[model samples]
Target: MKIYSKLTSLFIVVVLLGTLSMRPSEKKILIFFETKGYYHESIPTGVAAIQLMGQQNGFAVDTSRTSEIFTDEKLSIYDAVLFMSTTKDVLNEEEQNAFKRFIQKGKGFVGIHAATDTEYEWPWFNQLVGAYFKSHPKQQDAVLHIKDSKHPATKHLPKTWKRWDEWYNFKDIQPDLKVLITLDESSYTGGENGSNHPISWYHSFDGGRAFYTGLGHTHEAYSDPLFLKHVLGGINYAMGKK
Candidate 1:
């Protein structure tokens, strides 16, 4: 009877160890969507989509609508921070500083859609996000030219991808950005950036990594598997997984 009990205990221990070994290291992401200007109704959809991506990809995701979680302690637990359609002055001076410190420590940041329309007064943030939103035409169909198909964020995309979204014309464009995608001004109206209009980019900034994509303006974009995969690739790149 004692031998039977010992055998059962040993079997349980072996199963436990096997389970532990099969588990991968967990990575976490924080989605911040505090909006001080035009708030996209699609924010909730975007958040839910990211949560789904995390679940399917074996990562963890958390969402926030306030700047309270910018502290070193709170931000420490996250592998990346993503600004999901955040607009205009979302963070206070203190929170900005905290975020700067967090990035200086080699953390990651991903920006989507209106993230460029935010923090106009903060030059550092403009550079961090890669560009400032100058203007955009009405939501219409346009062709996006994928500049670097080798990038994980753009690899799945076609050489010429046509889509309907609010196309932005940017100002204060950073010269050092690795542009992954560009807009074909001939394909749409109100394209003020002229021929070489960059739409998505990534770079290393102040000891951290940064990626931005100008997609995700519509609710349908959140439900798109291709768009979601693009965003996930950006997240993975920011998290140093790519």
Candidate 2:
């Protein structure tokens, strides 16, 4: 009777261990916000959208202040990093090196709105962002032309969608960027003579996927259902889900 009892106890322990080990772990994504920016409201709204998407897709979302986080070790703990409308020069030398290494290590990154206006002094970061902010024609209602519909980020979006946001002109765009969406010159004022003003794009640089969208300039933009879906797709695509 003693031997039988001991065997039953061992079997139960083994089964319990197996069940615990079989449970899936949640994926985590980190969001870094540069709080020293003009468009503060938009960033928080964007973060909320990201959190909603994370919950829907079984991901754990983490957020940090720009001046407090962004160490190499802290960054490694996440599968993806988001630069949410940050416009300040918040990163020091050590942080920049860490960030560069982070991308080289094959992770994911997303840049929204004013992210292009940041890190202008850092040449490598400028290239990573795909373009630097030159100027905006004006704050006007614009139409975003889906240049690459097959791309996971823009795939679900309509061919031409109307949105109200601050359109930006970027300077010294890197040649290798895979342009995803452009602003339709006909729908807005203030673009240079060229018709193709890239508003959103994604590229793999330094062994990691990087995505940037020039939308999200206003809180209203983030609340829009269609805009939220677009942002969600971009985040998932960057994380290799879409």
Candidate 3:
């Protein structure tokens, strides 16, 4: 009986140590860049930046550049989905359905730059992005107005930030979206109509978290510490992390 009790205690210790050792790993993020529009030059840069950020932030990162995004099973495996400068109608009906289902599952999404230029025909994607790319005046220096400084993505940013990129105008944005930053048309050369332009914002749609940023016009921008932090914070938040 004494020997049996000692062996039983040893087995329990081994089982507990194995259970603790086998905790699930950190979540992974997959970035897709199927660009066919104005910001093609920035896609590779954006993907590279995301890869670096994943390493810095301790998350596994993978990437693909296919318009045929049709894996419902694979979509469920990722913590976040990042659309990097994809323009034009890429996904077919089945793929769109898969994407919709992916968001419906309460995952996260991050849209960078020309992601606004994509899925103009898909109203769901337009709202998910919080805006669509209408047109840009020209690529030049412009000042970004930080609207809500309390947002995790913009909390560390300055009130009036100047960056060089193509500014996008959106159509019929929902009033419910909490706009994080707007363009200072006065400080910029274009944006003549001065409609409410949302450069960065977050929203909960279809039971999932979404984040979009319209600032990635150049690859260099992604490497900048502040810009990287903005993207990282948005990505992390969408992944349900603080």
RMSD of model 2 against the true structure: 2.6
RMSD score of candidate 3 (Å)? 3.2
What TM-score number comes out for model 3? 0.89
* Model 3: residues with Cα > 4 Å off, grouped in runs: 1-24, 192-195
Q: Is candidate 1 or candidate 2 better by lDDT?
A: 1
The Cα error of candidate 3 at residue 7, in Å, is 9.9
* Count of backbone collisions in candidate 3: 0
lDDT (10s digit) by residue, model 2, range 108-179 = 888988888888789998888899888886688988888898887788889988888888888988888898
Global CA lDDT computed for model 2: 0.83
Q: Write the per-residue lDDT of candidate 3 for residues 1-242, one digit (tens) a residue.
A: 99999999999999999998897668788898875655478778788888988887789898888846557987878888988888878788888999889889898999888888888899998878887777788888888888988878999999989988878877757566878888888877768437566788999998999998988888678778888888888898788886
In model 3, the worst 10-residue window by lDDT is 189-198
Please list the C-alpha lDDT of all candidates, in the order they appear: 0.93, 0.83, 0.83
lDDT of 1: 0.93
Q: TM-score winner among the candidates? A: 1
Error of 3 at 72 (Å): 1.2
Error of 1 at 194 (Å): 1.3
Candidate 2 local Cα displacement, residue 52, angstroms: 2.1
Error of 3 at 98 (Å): 0.5
RMSD of 1: 1.7
Candidate order by lDDT, highest to lowest? 1, 3, 2
